[model samples]
Target: MPGSSILVTTDKESVARRMESLHVFRLKLLSEEMCWLILSQKAFTGRSQASREILEDIGRKIANKRQGLPLAAKTSGVLLQDKQGREEWQNVLNNVIWK
Candidate 1:
């Protein structure tokens, strides 16, 4: 006979309390903070290797967006690319910095 798997409750509060003894609380907090830092860097291409990369990237993108005569829109695409890079850089920063 095959063993039956148990169905655990999917409640957020319950899950959080259970994670206290399992040591996942700290990990979750770190993950959240890292995610915030990464997602906030939707500029500058997020290429920096530090937690503040998002802030720096945002600043860079703003600067880049301002580099033009008559307000050319050539740098718009760079903003999109930088947004993606910011997400990736977040993961890298979290894994390398927090790990």
Candidate 2:
């Protein structure tokens, strides 16, 4: 069976909820470049150590991206918005490490 078959089920609402959780990564509004950087790191390394480094890099980049924003203000939102964003996100997913 295909790998994607595991993600399929008869319950559409449950599937939609799962998809939403999987799709949305907490990201700052101006961190497009940082997101791409994380995506690239994730694409290259398959080892557990490399995975930790990639997550660390992502967290660090998000911290840096939040530097200019207000002290009291916190921005949290989905990583992808429209069709183009979804396409780009899927391209990243296609190259990711699945350990």
Which regions of candidate 2 deviate over 4 angstroms?
A: 1-27, 46-99
Local distance difference test, per candidate?
0.38, 0.38
Q: Pick the candidate with the highest TM-score.
A: 2
> Which pairs of residues clash in candidate 1, taking residues 3 or more apart in a chain or in different chains?
41-54, 43-57, 44-57, 44-61
96: Cα error in model 2, Å? 18
State model 1's lDDT. 0.38
Mind giving the per-residue lDDT tens digits that candidate 2 earns over 1-99? 575633333324565576654553333444555444443443334435554444444334433444333221122112322213334544433433311
TM-score of 2: 0.20
TM-score of each: 0.18, 0.20
lDDT of 1 at 51: 40
Each prediction's number of clashing residue pairs: 4, 0
Worst 10 residues of 2 by lDDT: 72-81
Cα RMSD, model 2 = 15.3
lDDT of 1 at 55: 49
RMSD of each: 15.2, 15.3
